[model samples]
Target: MFALYITHPQVRIDPDVAVPKWGLSDIGSARARLAAESAWAGQLRRIISSNEVKAIETANILASASGVPVEIVEGMHENDRSATGFLPPPEFEMAADWFFAHPHDSFRGWERAIDAQTRIVSKVEAILAEHDPQAPIAFIGHGGVGTLLKCHIAGRPIARQGDQPAGGGNLFCFDLANRAISCDWTPMESWKGESRKG
Candidate 1:
């Protein structure tokens, strides 16, 4: 069987509030709706989401459609950029580049990419350890850590190439039994939920 790893869609950018508290924009909600109605969405037996509002909202949308409950999973948040606060897109992109380029080093007090990767890997592995792999599942989270998890499962080095395309709301899939990534990031609305023989 395969499990989906989904990144929350576009958020209502609020320069005034903490980033994690940001919720989905109208467009994001619509996209989430489309994804929820996707044929593959019905295959999901459970949804696990990061505690961030955006992720939870996305998971809730999908969960409602799948007739499953959304389970909040702590420690699955985006890389800690709260230390530096919000940066304009250009500056933020540059910092993100540095963050990936130097996975072992902190960029301006932000969490080291390697550390974040380790944390995500540990938490996901723990989840897998406890879950029954007979059914498919989805993990709703942020792009940074989702990419980190992708890279780890693919046995690739930490790099931005694994990151989702601009605008978020994307997903990847991996085999639940063997922990091998089977797909790269695809927009949630467009993905067909490719089948896995497992």
Candidate 2:
């Protein structure tokens, strides 16, 4: 009854390409492979992912290693920033801070942080409600919404403090039965802990 919410790893950042279409970099793939080799990977019975390419790629690597079929869940995407299009990293950081700091307000017409959190929580709950609670599941997604989900599960207020560290390829675990977080965000490949193995 354990569930891991995992964010995809580093991606090929190209200014010309659509952000969602960008796949993992070589280092990202290698990191995912290493994480898949962990003993924890063997315990996963279900794998779900966002429709984004990077998340799907990460899910595929994990599914291949675990022999679990990857299922795409439609509503599990990154927060909708399409309204403002892509911003450079520095600008992105500023926008993200605004997103979390002002949960009720939309920054530059993007999805309101509160709204995104609600959607993610609703979708995740619906998915869990339909699945076998006795089975352990993994959900692969992007950092933005992943942090939002983490905050909900952790009973934390919307804040950047709840977000993952700078890089990607991170995860946190919670109990499927009660939705209580057992572990906070940590590196997917290197963290060794009770929750990590579940």
Candidate 3:
């Protein structure tokens, strides 16, 4: 069995809206629909999602095909960026770079990258601890913390090098029995449940 960590695709970015409340854009919803029809989505026995709207929307789309309920987990959110609210694209990218570069330090009052990594890893471990090894599961979340979790799984230090592709809607898989990474990031619609390398 395998456990997949999936990142939500593009979202409707509204400066006035709280980041956590942002929903999927049209493209994101379409991508989720495509992924929902994949073999991997059909094989999922459990679908866990972050409470964020975008994540929940992605999880629901994937779950619709399998009829599995989306389990919204509280602490599976993205690295807290509420401190700076919304930054323009270039500035946001720079801030993100700094966030990864200095994992132990906060970027403009944002949550420290190290702390976010710890939170995501702990949440994932707790979920896996109670999960059935015989069943396949999917966790839907954001890019930042998802990368953090990937770093922990790969036994590497946190770095932006491990982040998903620009558009998101990607996933990586790990073995359920040993929690070893079985696949690197792949577009969700194209994965087909195959496991390659970390």
What lDDT would candidate 1 get against the real structure?
Answer: 0.92
- The candidate, 1 or 2, that scores higher on TM-score is 1
For model 3, what is the error of residue 53's alpha carbon versus the real structure, in angstroms, after optimal superposition? 0.2
**Candidate 3 structure lDDT:** 0.93
Top candidate, metric TM-score: 1
Q: Could you tell me how far off, in angstroms, the CA of residue 157 lies in candidate 2 after the best superposition?
A: 1.5
Off by over 4 Å in 2: 193-198
Residue 10, model 2: lDDT of 92
* Model 1, residue pairs in steric clash: none
What does candidate 2's lDDT look like per residue over 1-198, in tens digits?
688999999999987877888899999999899889887777789999999999999999988767989999898999988887779999999999999999999999999989999988998989998989888889999888989999888888988898998879999988877888888888999756353332
After TM-score superposition, the amount by which residue 90's alpha carbon in candidate 1 deviates from its true location, in angstroms, is: 0.5
Lowest lDDT sum, 10 consecutive residues, model 2, at 189-198
RMSD of 2: 1.6
Clashes of each: 0, 0, 0
**Evaluated with lDDT, which candidate comes out highest?**
3
Predicted candidate 3 versus true structure: per-residue lDDT over 99-187, tens digit per residue: 99999999989999999999999999999999889889999999999999999999999999999999889999999888888889999
Poorly placed runs, candidate 3 (over 4 Å) = 195-198
